[model samples]
Target: MAQPAARTGPGPRRAQDIFAATFALLTELGYDGLTVEGVAARSGVNKTTIYRWWPSKDALLGAALIDSRLFELTVPDTGTLRDDLHALLDQMRKLLTGEEAGAVVAAVLSAATHRAELAEVTRSFFLDRLGRELPLFERARRRGEIRAGLDPKTVIDLLAGALWVRVLLRGEAAPAGFVRETVDLVLRGVAA
Candidate 1:
């Protein structure tokens, strides 16, 4: 006897739906406010189904963090370091100004303080996705677009660190001209 046709697409599609729902819920409600039950309700899946895939909400959200293309900002290569940096900064300005950013920041911070796995996942996601920008700096240096002897990692840190300081520590939003000015200051050191 011929067996019934094997089911296809349901597992992967359901997983994607779950991740998307989790991200949406995280954005709407901070990590502390999120719950598996809410995600199940939102995704139309039973709570047991969520538990079977993800051992905890942190794990589910962690997976969602990597899956979501929300942080995939455009990093253009304009054949010149200055122009490329400016374009990247412009994209950052748009991201930083968005409502979702605040929510993401809050969720990550809260998770970091309470959940070790979540913190690791967040760090890994940032390093994997954002770290690619380092190559842009390296290319600029090789092409003599920017000063030689510059450390790509250091430069990336400075760029992201400054923005983080402004947003997380100072509680101020990045201004429109901040990115251009930042690139200039970093490339050409301050002078008396």
Candidate 2:
């Protein structure tokens, strides 16, 4: 494959093309099948440039996932832990059960099983995503909705696990009110 010369200077568009190509190929080819050369060719960015920006396949995919912001969650401050979690989980329900991004995530996660590269990137992606919700917990603590020491990570894991199981594993939509009930249960645990 003929490599396009690396773009010269100051090109966010270059990064955008690269990330878009990464996702496209990620969806088309499983992680084990995705290649920098493929992304470079698809994006019209040079493979060397992609490598310069990201040292390895995992790094490239991780950068693409984070930079794409495809899985971003909006954490709402509803002034109560239950409401906030309900809102958050509702968003998750949409993403996990929705068609587009959900398919991409499922592809990557399925590929992660056999590919260490995919696993590393997927792990970082999930952790960073979960970390982004920290302020929700922070605000709840300030409002006395939960204790300061309450572990948000566990709560996040549990809530996400519920949706992932229903949507990813069982291929079922989360029943109506499931999000709110899950939130209430988790909030109740931290309430005392």
Candidate 3:
């Protein structure tokens, strides 16, 4: 009999599908209701495969958040701090404005509130992902685009918070020029 092939993780498309299913289920069922079986059925991945890839629901959700569009944000280097911030915020705006995303975000937050493991995973996941943007801030500093004493985390919080309020809190997409104007206002305060 032939031996089984060495198994690696799901490919990008498979992973995306799994992650998307995870969020859709999360939106529908909330965190406690999400399970690897449901993920397998929804994503068309085997239940054993999902369990093999991620040991627990927390772990699976962690990976899903890492891979999903709503959480897996990338920082853009637009050669200028202004453009970079605008681009980043625009990406966030799109996510925040997504119909299912807001519900999923709220569900995640609600679930995180009740689950310590989930809260830690959520915290670390955001920190780890958001930390990637530090490089963009460092680049801005090198180029004398922002003040020497500027705090990247604070700036990010300010910008992201504005968008979150507009979308999640106010339940509205960002009005025209919101990203640009927000970036302009933030850069004015932090500009070199």
Candidate 4:
């Protein structure tokens, strides 16, 4: 995992340390089993420092999600809309199928049911990541790479919905070649 960019100015390093440590713990122990005290021990930072930074465990986890590169995936432009979408989905498939990814997904979903605020934060995190891919589709539309009259948001949701169903409900690994088929279906439409 990539480290957060170095912070300049006063008191930034402490905050980064706390966030990094929190993310490490969350990835390891998960949301239900995580504790601030464990974060303090793992980070070598004091509990007072954590409390001073974040009010609650959820808040810390939220910030950690943002700070960590676990959600910092970049959508690549491969000159064609289908290729670009495939690249992005391939990255997501890797993430969803990884060892730590399952725990991370479960943690986010578990947080959503009991904690509205955390849910919102997690939603924002996903939206922010997905938002990065939208402009690629828009650019492709302008280039006539995608079919006209197709809504970018709808296309995005369509692809994401399929992947999420597999990840969240079925708990099955995203199969290889799934992204290619999805991109083909999206571009060509559902017509036989």
Worst 10 residues of 3 by lDDT: 65-74
Segments of candidate 3 deviating more than 4 angstroms: 1-7, 69-74
Best by TM-score: 3
Which parts of model 2 are misplaced by more than 4 Å? 1-11
Question: Which candidate do you rate higher for TM-score, 1 or 4?
Answer: 4
Winning candidate number (lDDT): 3
TM-score of each: 0.77, 0.85, 0.87, 0.80
- 10 residues in a row with least lDDT, candidate 1: 183-192
Q: Choose 2 or 3, whichever is better by TM-score.
A: 3
After TM-score superposition, the amount by which residue 126's alpha carbon in candidate 3 deviates from its true location, in angstroms, is 1.6
User: lDDT tens digits, residues 1-192, model 1?
Assistant: 999977342376787788777877887887777899999999999998788768799878777776655556777889877777778766766666677765676667766888788888788777775576876876776786656566666766777678777776677878868878887887675111
Candidate 4's displacement at residue 137, Å, is: 1.6
Alpha carbon lDDT of each predicted model:
0.74, 0.81, 0.84, 0.74
Instruction: List clash counts for every candidate, in order.
Output: 0, 0, 0, 0
The TM-score measured for candidate 2 stands at 0.85
TM-score of 1: 0.77
Q: For residues 7-106, could you state the per-residue lDDT of candidate 3 as single tens digits? A: 7888888888988888888888878789889999999999998888888888888887776766657789889988888888888887767677777777
> Which order, best to worst by lDDT?
3, 2, 4, 1
Candidate 3 matches the true fold with a TM-score of: 0.87
Off by over 4 Å in 1: 1-17, 46-55, 146-149, 189-192
lDDT of prediction 2: 0.81
- Cα displacement (Å) at residue 80, model 2: 2.3
